[model samples]
Structure formats: C-alpha cells, structure tokens
Target: MARRGKKKGRPVSGWLVFDKPVGMGSTEAVSKIKWLFQAEKAGHAGTLDPLASGMLPIALGEATKTVPYVQDGAKVYRFTVAWGEERSTDDLEGPVTKTSDKRPGEAEIRALLPNYTGVIMQTPPQFSAIKIAGERAYDLAREGETVDIPAREVEIGRLELIETTPEGNSIFEIECGKGTYVRSLARDLGRDLGCYGHIATLRRTEVFPFTADDLVPLDALEAAAPKREEAAPEGGRPFAAQGERFVALDAFLLDTGEALDCLPQVAITDDAAAKLRLGNPIILRGRDAPVQADEACATARGKLVAIGEIEAGMFKPKRVFAG
Candidate 1:
C-alpha cells in the first residue's frame, strides 16, 4: 500500500488585528484564530500578557514574514495604575507584596510625567516572559527563585495622565517604541511618587500602523466562521473548500503589504521583481527615487515582491515574498 499524504490547512495569508480580551494569552489567541480559519501557519507580532488586553496583531502565512516590521513599530497603550498596592507580577494577576497609603495629587502626577518621558532605564517585572540564562523569568519567579532582571533603556515618545479616580487609581496613556514595558512604568511611577502601585487595567490602543478601529473581537471572528454544514458543497466533504468565498476567513485579513506601511515603498518592473524573487540584486530606475532609509519595500503591479536595501543604486533583496 502507498503511504498517505500529510493533512494540511488552508494557505491563508495577511494580518488580523485581534482585540485580545483580558485573561487570554497571546499564544491562546493565535491558536483560536488558527483553528477558526484553519490556516496553515499563524503567529503574533507582539506578546500581550493575559492580564492585559487589546491590539494583538495576528499574522498568518506570508504576513508572518512581515512581523518584524510591525513589531519594530511604535505602540500606544492606555492603562490604569492603582496607587497604594504593588504586586509580584506588577499587574492585578499577582499577589500584593507591598502597599502604601500615599496617593499623589493630580498636580503631583503631572509634575512627575516629564521624568518618565524620553529615554529611560527600566527593570522588567520578575514574573515576565523575558528569559534569563535560557529560562523564563516567570518560571523562576513562580518556583520562588530569585530572578534578577536587568534594566534596559527604552524610548517613551509621549506620556500623559488621562484621568484620576477618587479611589486613588490614575489612568494614563503612553506612546513608546518597542521593548517599553508598561508594567515597569507603572511600578516606577509609584516608586517615584513614594506610593507603591500596580496596573489595575491595561489596554493597547495602537501598534504602529494599526489602531483600535482595526481590531476585531474574537467573538466576532468566531461568529463569522462559516457553519460546517453551510460550508459543504454538493458531492464535496465538509469544510474542505479553499479560498475566501468558500469560508469567508479572508474577509478579516489585511493585505500583507499594509504591515510594511511604516517603511518607504518603491515600485519596480516585472523583470526587477522576478530578479529579486530569485535572490538577485537589480539596479533601480532613475524615475524611482532612492529610498533614504536603509530598507524599503519593493512592489510590482501592486504586489509586494521583496523587502531589500538600497545601496549605491542597487536594490539587494533581504527577504523575498511569494507573490
């Protein structure tokens, strides 16, 4: 008897701006979407904690290749800092380890905002995903082992106090570059104000090119999946059809090129696209001005072909995408 072929899922491609609800891990969210779409591959651009919510960019198939671009993009978050209590995880999920009676006034909080703005050093929470010595910090923390996370410099483009509750909780919105941890900021702000704090509620409003408006709630996506019986065609097996019309999964997929919107783009000829796809460098035409940035996205006939570098009139393909 001949060996059987391996089972495969749909070759779905593009980005899904998942509005990750609280209590759902980033990996869990990705798995749910993957199962719903039956996509061949899926991954998230950034990891959002279970205690945190919003704007988790899910990339499928070719979109996974553009994750780095989206990950490197700036992010905006709105979070609440509950003054007077500090937790082991720096968020509500952790046990309270310290508490303070002091709560800063609205004026006091405003005065201290400047200190956190711009480049600053921050130590990540012990119960975090950051690895130390090939082990996750959270694992060590959970095991009651001392996990010393080092402080690193992160850029905060903007930080503003959005609101203050009568009960001592302060809401804030921050715009920062990649690697900036909101948990650390909340912890540091409390320390700075002489009032210990932990994040009560957290939500990411934007990630670079994507905003809150782009997010699709998990419930919405699940409801959109075609019913098994409805998806079956005459004389065909159930849920075995390919393409968007058959399943409607592609309706949620944003064009893969949209992920690279932050970078400058150049249009190339069909010949150049073919050369780039073959891992070859081609001379850019004079009409297409050289990109000042080191890396640029090259497209032909409105389809992304390669992400490459411009050096001395030569475009060298760093990564080529299947058209």
Candidate 2:
C-alpha cells in the first residue's frame, strides 16, 4: 500500500469566541472558521440558530475535546417577543399560525416571570434539532408532519423583563441551563398572558466561560486575514501566505485549557504527566493533594496533560492530551 500522506491543514488548537451574525448557521460558521485558519479539525460547543447571534465558542484541533464542558454551561440570551402572533416555527422566520389582537400589559408580563423562573417542563419548538425516531424534528416539520415533541425539565436560572416596547413587543433576558429554548419561553409566556407571541429578535450574549466581551465580529475577523500574494517566488515554491495568515489568526484563539476552567486543576510533575499519558494512574502525593474529585484536569509546566477522575488517591486518566 502507498504511504498515507500527512493530513492537510495546520494543527491549530484553541477556542475562538465568535460573535456569529444573524442569518449564518452554526455549522457554516465552524466550516468557515476552519477554512480561515486552515485547521485540521474544528467544532462548536453549542448550536446557535441562524436567526440568533452572539457568543459561539468555536474549538479547533485539541480544543474540540473540551466542547462538552462549554456546552453544559449556562447560556444567557436577550430576546424580544412580538405580541399578537404565534408562528409555526416560534420565531419571525415562520408563518403566523395563530394571532390575537390582545396585548399583554407590562404588569401582566412581570407577574408571569416568577412562574417561569425555575425548573419547569418545556416543549421544544417544532423546528428544532430534536430527534424523533432517528429523524430530525425540523425535517419532519418541514415536510408538513406534526411530530409529538414531549416536554422535558429545563432550568431557568433567571428571567427578567427588561422593557416592553410600545410597538407591542417585550424584551427580556434569561440565564438558562442547557436545552432551554427561548422560543418556547416566548410562546408559553404569551399563551399564559392571553396574547399570542413569537420571537422577533434574539441574541445570545453569553455561553459559560465566555461572554460578550470575548466576542469578535465576523467582519473584524475577515479584515484580520492576511492578503495573499499574487505570484510565486522565482526558483522556489510559492511563499507560505496561508501559513502566515494562520499565524496571524492564531492570536485570537483562547488557550485550550480555558474550556476546562470550570473544573478543578491539579499541577503534576513531569514523571506523573508521563504516566498519565501512557494511560496509567498516578498516585496523588503531598498533604495538599486532593483525596478525591469526580472530575479534574492535570497540567504539567503550564500545559494540559489529562482530564481524569481521582479515586483511591490516584488520578486515572480518562482523556489524555498530546502537546
């Protein structure tokens, strides 16, 4: 057999906190980010609907291993609900399936907030990524088939009514655990208040371990890309413009260990790091060593070594990292 050639693209690794603009799908953003960086691998921590915009943490190369950490983190969204219309898709993108002239008073909305602020059962919108019988709910809905999407418990940490617009819209912000749907919140809120509603504007401001402050707009990122040279150098291969650009973009990436920030960290010596890399357990020594931890990360000389479970005073590697 012919020797397998090296995989294409750079092995760039880190999180790019992207401020994804509206109208761009999450998968599309990941593909573009990968191409721009010439990365060998890329993935996103959470999915942001094309209609929504904000903190989308795109992980490249080794950072992809930590995606679950960010996905499990709480998310914050600021959204506006337009009263008098309930759309089939639960947002402005869908056609209005129901409408009512009745509008919700600010007081009525404020009173209802308390009822939604906590753990509650919520039915996801018809046009969601939820799978039913191995098929996407949205695909079935698009085919004009109504799927029975069962309600499930979702935690709403905070729900605040920021302001009610005179145009018959209410702006609210929420910090919610994973799988909470803002569209469902608006739809259910309207039903309780005797006013049909749909999401008019939605923006995700934060994903745990990242915030609006870390966001970089698509335009800014495109502008940062290096301009490519027109021709190859004489008697030599073309100048590595793509490689140079990769270096330039690398500046924007957050450290891969940043994704594991929520987990407790333990510093390990080179000897211990070597053992962990070989899929062996290392005994935790010293008085300050943790007796036990359900999950924690070990670092050696400021570099991540492994994420593992501590049991019986030994750290058993679960996922090891390559430098």
Candidate 3:
C-alpha cells in the first residue's frame, strides 16, 4: 500500500499496519515502530512468532487504547505444514516430538478441513505466551512442568486446504476468530486427519480491518522523516499530525462495523462533553438505548468532544476508541 503521508511536523496518532517479515518477533516489531515514530507510546494488537510473519497491527499514541478492539477481529492466515513429522511446539521451532505412519495428500487435507470449521475449543500449546498463574506458560513447559492450560473457545470461520507439494508439504488458509494459535490449529488438523503434522511456515494475511496490503514495510517505517525516537520511551507516545484529528474516538470500533452496526450513535451538546471529560458518566439518547463513550475528551463549555458506550440503564463504558 502507498504511504499515507502526514502533514509536515504533525504528531501522528493512528493505526499503522505492518507487513512483518520473517524472523522478527511481534514485540520487536512494536519496538521498531516505537523507535521510528519516536512517539510517547505504542503497542501491537496481537503477537506473531519470530518464525512466522505477516500483518502486524501497530498502535501509535492514543491509538494504543484501541488495541483490544482490533484484537477481537477475526484473523486469516496462510500456512504450510510438513507431513509425517510432529514437533513438540507444533511448529518447526520445536524439536521432533513424534512421527506418523503415513502422509496425507492434497485431496485428503481439503476434505478434512470442513470438520474444523465453525465453533471449536482450542487447547493452546504450552509453548505460548498465555499466562498460567501469572507466569508465562511456555517457560513453565520448557522446564518440564505440566501445567493444564484450559481450552478456550475459538471459531475457524473458514478453512481451505489449498495445495500439497510432492515432498509432503501442505498449504492451507484459515480465517478464525481471536485467541487462535495457527500452530495449535496445525496440530489439531493433523490429529483430526490421523496424519500428524507440523507447521513449516506461517504468515498472517489479515486481521479484521487491517490486512497485509494496508501495511508499511518495516524498512519504510524505520526510514520515516523527522524521526521521533529521541524523546520517547520504549513504546513511545501518541503523535498527532498537525493539530488533533477528529476520528470520532470510536473509529477503530466503527472500522469493524460490528459494534457500530449493532449500536446507534448519539450526538451530544458541548455540555455533555464537558461533564464527560470531568469523569461524570452521562447517558445519551439513541434508538436502541442510551449510549455513552467510555472515555470523553473535554473541550470548551462541557461540550461532548468524545464519548464511549455505556451499559443499558447504567453509565458504564463498553468501549471508547481514541480520536
């Protein structure tokens, strides 16, 4: 995608999608952007292993506040699996944990994918960042301790086995909801088909509103002008272009169009914005119910600059994105 250049001397505070290259950890990607932008804060929506790469969402400035909203969006990945061998980590990064009797062909994989679709529970591999009792699960697993990481609900909206190489390599694409581990999915697919498998390669093609095409290359990000790294810390801080841009403070959620489509927008007067800025929750009128922005920025005259969604009959925020 073309670079969406900002006005000269503008502090940027918006979403930046990166077409991550192989060998960079997700946190490493965040650090690169934080250093490049030199903003005060930054965060990535999700994690991608160093061995696997693709669309990684980097949140800049106040946009970091909306990271969780995009995290819930379904992700699509393109991965290749090696047949006949199973790894302890479910991917090539781990040691050869087991071997199977036979290999499955392209046709067999395509036929087996349908069974993994729709709602399913996934038991994440112990070699994951998921915390069990506040310690990283992967670290514990490496120490040979058995920790039962509970199975969580996830959905594979679409699964298509695209091709199989003559050398026992199978490629597939999957669109799944949040909390999905492509590695685990690879392991499970192997078990379901009775031909053990290990992920040889993986790449995230899309994450909800963002996609690989929407991203800037790591090299490009590392080369942006007016380099903002000097005064900023690790994640950096929000940098808006020019004066503050008006992004409805809910643009991130609206980008998904789920909560936005389901919830009605309610405009408020300046008075409401002022009270909201001061931290007093107020319900605004909407057709379905009263909606409030979980967070609001105060302007002049208690005007409603930004607002978040509130619970029914109570002033509690559902979500409020940054402006």
Candidate 4:
C-alpha cells in the first residue's frame, strides 16, 4: 500500500475567540473556522446553541489539546427570561408547553435568586446535547420522546436580575461554573414564581481564560480572508495564500499556551525539554521550583514543551506539544 499522505491544511496552532452570531451552531462554526484558517484540526471548547450568541473559543491544530481547560472554567451568561410562557425546548425556538397569567414582581424574583445561587441540582433542558444510550437527547426530544435527564450539581457563583422589562421579560446575568444551563434557570425560576418562562435571549460574555474583549466577529474574519472570487482556477476554491489576507486573519489567533496560563508554569532547561519531549521525566532544580503539583506546563526558551505533573521535584510529561 502507498504510504498514507499527511493530512491536508496548515499546521496552525492557537485559539480564536469568536463572537458567534445567533442562529449558528457550534459545530458549524468550528467547520467554517477550520476551513478559513486552513488548519489540519479544529475543535471548540464549549458548544453554543443556535439560538445563543457570544464567546466561542475555537482551537486549531495543537491548541485542541487544551480545550478541556477552557471548558472546565467558569462561564458568564447574560440572558432574558420571557415570563408567562414555558417552551418545550426552554427557549423561544420551541413551542409553548405551558403558560400562566401570573407575572413575577421584581421583589419576588430577587428573593428567588438566593435559592439558585451556590451549588444546586439542576436538570438539563430536554432539547439539549446530553447523550442517553448513545443517542442525543435533542434527537429523542424532536421525535417527542421525553428524556428524564438527571439533575446535576452545578455551581452558580453569582446570579443577578439585571432588570425587568415592561413586557414581563426579566434580564439576568449569571456567573456560573461548567455544565450550568441558563435555559433551565429560566424554566425553574418561572415555576418557582408561579409564572411560566423561556429564554428570550442568551449571550455568553465569558468562558474563563477568554472574555468578550478577545472576541472577533464572524463578518470581520470573513472580510479579512481571501475571497473565493480570487481563486486562480475559475471553479476551484481559493488556495490559502500566505499574504496580507492570511496575515490579517492569523493576527486574531491567541497563543496556544494562553489556555494553559492558569496552570503553574515551569521554566525548564533545554536539556530537560528534550527529555520531556522524548517522554522522560527530568529533575527540577532551584529553590523556587515547585516540588509537587498535579498539573503544570513546562516551557523552554519561551516555547511550550509539555503539560505534566510535578512530584518530588521531577517533571513527568503527560502531553507533549509539537512545534
């Protein structure tokens, strides 16, 4: 058999914090971005629903290895709950499942906020990405199959009612940990306040290491890319040219190590980096060197070597990076 050819696309590595517009799914965003960057591999840190918008961090090439860190960090969402109606999907996208004539007052909503703060058990929306028996819950929900998604422990660092609209829509901003759902919060709040509710609008402002400030809108990225009309072959796709357009687009990518900044950074010697790259442990020197750490990153001459564990002054590689 012929030797398998190397995978196509550029060996790009970094994170792109995208401001995903509403009506675009997370997977679609990843595919589009991968093509634009001409990257060999691409993945997203967290999934953003079609009805939601904001900070979606897309990882290209080697950056995909750090996705879990971003996913496990705190997330902040600003959402609006339209009172007096509960939808099947917990958002405006779904049909109304229940309704109530009752509307909650600001005082009542404020009082209920305490119940949701801190660690609490919450059931994910039925029309969610949760897997059950190797099938997506949303698929079953679309076919009218009711899924009893177990309530999971989620942390809400803070929950505040930003304001209430005259139309009975309550806007809220929440700082929460991984796996928390704003849709479920809206549904439960409505039930507690004797009013039915669904998410009217949802926008993620932060996903740990990345924030709104780092977000680059889709249109901006598109405008900076080489156009299909510029293709040399009339009916073929435009090749990724390492010109002004590519440079402009590449400027948006953050360093791969940016996602790992939260972890302890160990400056290793060139020799130590070589050993770590070969899947070997090296003794850490110096009084300031960490004697023990569950997770840390090793860098040599400002280049990431590996993500590993530090025990008894030894740095053991868990995952090594490719330059």
lDDT (tens digit, per residue) of candidate 4 on 1-323: 79997677767789999999999999999999998877789999989999999999999988999999999989999999999999999999999999899988999999999999999999999999999898999999999999888899999999999998888789999999999989999999999999989999999999998878899999999887767544222354334443344777889999888898789999988888989999999999998999999999999988788999999999999999975
Clashing pairs in 1: none
Task: List where candidate 2 sits over 4 angstroms from the true fold.
Answer: 1-5, 228-244
Query: What would the per-residue lDDT of candidate 2 be over residues 1-323, giving only the tens digit for each residue?
Result: 89997666667788999999999999999998887776779999989999998889999989999999999999999999999999999998999999898998888899889899889999999999999999999999999999999999999999999997879799999999999999999999989988889999999999999978889888877777654442223365433434554555678889889889899899999999999999999998989999889999999998889999998889999999886
Alpha-carbon error at 25 in model 3, in Å?
Answer: 1.1
Q: How does each model score on TM-score?
A: 0.92, 0.94, 0.75, 0.94
lDDT, candidate 1, at 136: 95
Higher-ranked by lDDT: 1 or 4? 4
Model 4 segments more than 4 A misplaced = 229-245
Q: Runs in model 1 with CA error above 4 Å? A: 1-7, 229-241, 244-247, 291-293
Q: After superposition, how far is residue 61 of candidate 4 from its true place, in Å?
A: 0.6
Evaluated against the true structure, the overall lDDT of model 2 is 0.89
Clashes of each: 0, 0, 26, 0
TM-score, ranked from best to worst:
4, 2, 1, 3
Which of the predicted structures, 2 or 4, would earn the higher lDDT when compared with the native?
4
* Worst 10-residue lDDT window, candidate 2: 230-239
Model 3 weakest 10-residue run by lDDT? 253-262
Over the stretch 1-323, how does candidate 1's per-residue lDDT look in tens digits?
Answer: 99997555667788999999999999999998888787778999999999899999999888999999899999999999999988988998889989998988999999999999899898988988889999999999999998778999999999999988878799999999999999999999989899999999999989989988789998888788877555434475423454544345668778899899877888999989999999999888776679455999899999889998998878899999988
TM-score, candidate number 2: 0.94
